[model samples]
Structure formats: structure tokens, C-alpha cells
Target: MKRTLVIGDIHGGFKALQQVFERANVTENDQLIFLGDYVDGWSESSQIIQFLIELSEKQECIFIKGNHDAFAEDWFSSRETPGVWLYNGGKKTVESYADYSPENLKLHLEFFQRMKNYYVDEENRLFIHAGYSSMHGPEREVYSSNYRWDRTLWETAVAMDKKLSRNSNLYPKRLLLYKEIFIGHTPTLHLGVKIPIMKANIWNLDTGAAFTGALSIMDVNTKEFWQSDPLPSLYPAERGRNK
Candidate 1:
């Protein structure tokens, strides 16, 4: 089995993302899957997009779209309401493209729209931005809405389904089912974990890295995890400078 590593929301924290990858020690054979929210919240959106594009060209990397990414796509593409993206932490994304004109903005928006909603491997390990519930259907039948919202439903389903599977091993073949699902979006602290960490058989890796928490990554097979130190407090003077 190939060792896969799924990362949480990056939110323009490129340096932190790099540190997590380094700690994971990704190999050429190991595929890295990102849970999205790649831009916004921080000031390095441009650099982070460039890096992700480069990595995608060389390695087996899959990108999933998060709600923040949806905002970015709309903002750059000029297809959304004017104030929505700007209100949703998109100020940094707009600033990231300061050097670009209208044409470049159009191109960037196209790139964001190209991102996938979710990824399901041969092992049925579902990688999505948020999560789906039983209403979305069984693990194999998840809907795109699950990827953008509906975590509470998914959590309830997982608890019930995993419990039943633990006892009966029925409903579907085990190999075709996911041993786990990886997601990001909602901050894990809100999920009751004292600290930012993976939880609920669904790895809640977001860690609020773009806000008060640190960025994080976890190994899919071994459960090993890595994170950057909490982001340093920035003075007003240093807020928008690219690292």
C-alpha cells in the first residue's frame, strides 16, 4: 500500500505547510492529498498557489476545494457578488494578486474553479474539504454538498455506521469502505478537542492555522502527525508583507 499523507487547510501559510511536509518526509511514491482552503487568511496566497502548482506537476498530489477556495474562485473570476469574497477573508487573496491585472485575475479564477470537490482512493479513503452525512448517502455515495457543508450530519452518521460496522461488518464490503475520511474547514477547537488535532475518525486537521491555531498534517496509514508552532503575533507594520 502506498503511504499517503493528507494535509489540512493551509490558508496561505506556505512556510507552515512546508514544515509539515518536511516532517511527514513525503517520498516520490507517497501521494499527498490536500484538503483545501489553500488561500486567504494569510498574506502568502500567491506564493502558496505557485508552490502547489509546481508540486502538482511533479508528484501525485490531489487538491480538493474548500469554501474559502470557492470564495477565491468567485472573487477572482468576477462571477460572484462583490462583497462576499472580501468579507470572507478574501482581502489577502486580492492583495496576493496585486501585480496582476484583470486578465491575470481571470486566469487565477479559472485555476481555482478547476480544483476537485473531493477525492476517494481505491481504499475508499474519502478526502474532502468538509464532510457529508447519511443524508448524502453511504460512504460511496457522498454528495458535493457534503464537501462544502454538513459536518454535523456526517459526524452522526459516522458514529452510528462505525459502531454497526464494528459489530456486524455488514452493509458494504470492508475493503471498499474507508478506514477513515480526511477533512478540513471547521476549526477543531470547536469540535471539543482542547487543542487543534485530528478527531472523529474524520481527521479535523484545519487547526485554524489561518487564525489562532497552528497548521497541521497527518500520515494516513500510521496516524503520525506534525504541526508548525503557533504563528507569531504580527505587528500592524508587518501584517501584509509576503514572507
Candidate 2:
């Protein structure tokens, strides 16, 4: 059977991305779902985009848009540098494109434009870069930015009383909308964990590849996961976003 692999935030750690793929033994037959933050952190941001563009031609791939991606897309279109973005790794992303021609840059911008804010599969499994606030679902979300910027969903999951049954009156209604919700953006490292974390029905795949942690990938069905070395070790000379 084909495996559906859910990947975490990449943050321009192309080497780490490559390592995880190989370690996972990924095949073209498998479906790849990337949770985004594809750029902005390490020095290989441009290269990662180019590689993904080429990889998509060989197999099925789903791309979800993250906040960093949105910021990069805005800059690509307007060339307006946001100070907040720069401090949070956008400077490296900008520098990564120094050698790119106008044509290639346009293609990368188009790729970013095509990314989805959230995706719900046939099994009622939601894949999103961050969190959604709508109890009705992402489709009914009033503020679209919440799809990529909200952390309340994960926070709720993390804070829930483990003894509280799902059928309880006090159980969060938002958790009932999907069988499983896979997300990135919030690093698992924040909780002092270095691996994909499952709280309630939500799965947080971001292993902090933008900082001192590893890049991670998981099989949605089996829950089996693979990871690359800690990003800092992979880029010894670079501080990544840890600074």
C-alpha cells in the first residue's frame, strides 16, 4: 500500500530535508504532504524551492502555506522588507536568491501563490501549517490569517485534561471536527520534546529544524517517523534561527 507522509516545517534546511527523506526510504509511490515554512532560516532557501519544484514533477505532493511562506511571498511581489520578517530569518532567504534570474524568481513566487492554507483529506484528517480558530472548520474561518498564524488549536490540545473524555460536555468542539489534525509552525522543542508530539487528536510535526532540532517526517497511517540530524550539526558554520 502507498504511504501518506506528513512532513514538518523545513525552514530552508535543505540538507536536513534530504537526509530525512533518505532515512525514511521515501518512494515516488508515496504521497508527500509538506506542512510548509519551506524557506527563511538556513542558507539554502532558494535551493529548497527549486528542488521541490522539480520533485513535484516526479510524484504527488501537497503544499500547505505557513506564515513565513506568506511573508516571503509578499516580499517577492512587493520587494518591501518587513523588519519583523528579517529578524526572524527572512534575511537569509533574501540572500539565498541572490543568484536567481528573474524567470526563476517568478516561478518560485508562483509556487508560493499556489500553496493551500489548509487541506482536509477523505478520512476527515486536516493538514495545516499552523492552527485554525473556526469551530466549523477552516473553510468557515473568518480570519484567513488564523490558518497560518493561530496557535490556540494546539495550545488547547496541549492543555486539555487527559482524563477528560472526548464525549464530555466540556470537551472542545473544535477537536471533534476531524479524526486527526496534523500541523507544523509550533516547534515541539518548545515543550522540551525533540520528536513529533501527539496531544489529544492533534499531531505536531515541527521538530524545530529552523533551530537546534531535527527535520522530521511521519507516515500518517502507521505513525512511523524518521528524522535527520539536528539542523545545527548539519550546518556547522551557520547559526540558523537559533540566534
Candidate 3:
């Protein structure tokens, strides 16, 4: 049986990662793909990155870049003020590597930079960090920003109820670009609130894990999904209003 496991935003949730594996009963034969945001929010950013790297070495693991991951990369790239890194979950990631030297940080940044924006299986099932819009372009020409910050672009695509053609730059006809696409970023529904988009055609496995939501995953071939209970809180309870 051909099996592929898609993991949602990790956000340094190592326990959640373990739970998902236990729930899915993942084995060596399974292919694992992470939707990004492996660091940030909770503790263990460095540990999680290293863990994921090791897993990648052993199996076919695909990594997508998320906004937080981008921030981490930017911090390492020396693109902005030193404090910028601390503001965007970089503190936790840095602490995770407290024992390492500057050289280690450089190496991790390199690894993050090489992570692909998306992955497409032979079946045409697209795995991306976030959704794309009609303004996107050819697979090779697709921009990383779309995967990192494209909720508005995808919202536009959803609003128009049409796939933006390749030539159309505002939004790339994402749906038309592939048979099916799996993405992270937006939380389909809050944890324990009876999500509105449960079991929809376009799978959203985020499950709001960064907030009170649980981490989720789905088997693309069978559409069999699994989620873990919410992990302990990292920040005080706060509600994020969605427009």
C-alpha cells in the first residue's frame, strides 16, 4: 500500500509530533512531509529542527517554509536588527541551541534556506506551506512568499471560485495547477469547537495548534486524518478574531 503522511504546523510541539506518529502508527515505509513552522511558539525549536533533520536523513521528508520559519531564516541571514529575531520566536529557537556556537546557527540557517516551498507527488497532490492564488505562476517560477504569506491571495481565489490561470500573476490557478493540494498556515477551526471545515475537499490540517488548537495530519491517498489533544499552553489564553 502506498502511504504518505502529511504533518501540520509543528510550532516546536515535539510531544504533539510524537502523538501524531503514535496515532498514525507510522513506520519506516511511510513517507513524511511537514508543512513547516517547526520552530517558534512553544519551546524546543532547535531540538525539533534537529530532530526533523535527522528524520529527513533516514526517510523521504519534505519541508515547507512558514512565516515563523522565514523569520528564523532572516535572523540567521543578518537581514534585520538583532532584536527582530527575538520578537518572532527566535528566542526559543536560539535557546534550544544554547550549547552550540555561531557556526551551528549558520549551518541551521543554510538548511532552512534550502527547504522547498512545496512538494508535488507523482499523483499531482500538492503539498505547500500555504495556499496560492490566481496570481501565482508556473511551478518553477512560483514565489516563496505565496507559500509564506498568501492567505489573502488564496482568499481571492476562493472568492472568485475559479483557478487563476498560469499567465495571471495576481493568483496562480492553484487548483488547476494540481489535482489536489495539502497546506498548513490557517487554522480550519479552533480546537474543541467543532471546526467548520472538517473533512472538506481542500484539506487543512493545522487544527490551530499554535493557539488552543490540536495538531493534525491526514493520509492523502485515503483521506484518513488524525489529530492529537491540545498540548499544554505556552501563552496566556487569547482569542484571535478572524475576518
Query: Which candidate ranks first by lDDT, i.e. highest?
Result: 2
Candidate 2 per-residue lDDT, tens place, 61-115, comes to 9999999999999999998999999999999999999988999999999999999
Count of backbone collisions in candidate 2 = 0
Residue range 156-240, candidate 1, lDDT tens digits: 5344554454435454332224667777887775655524354335567777776766778777778778887654443133342
Ordered list by lDDT, greatest first: 2, 1, 3
What lDDT, from 0 to 1, does candidate 2 have?
0.95
**Cα RMSD (Å) per model?**
4.5, 0.6, 4.9
lDDT winner between 1 and 2, please give it: 2
TM-score of each: 0.79, 0.99, 0.79
Per-residue error at 35 for model 1, in Å? 0.4
Model 3 spans with C-alpha error above 4 angstroms: 79-85, 135-143, 153-173, 190-201, 233-243
| Alpha-carbon local distance difference test for all models | 0.69, 0.95, 0.69
Count of clashes, each model? 0, 0, 11
Best-performing candidate as measured by TM-score: 2
Worst 10 residues of 3 by lDDT: 234-243
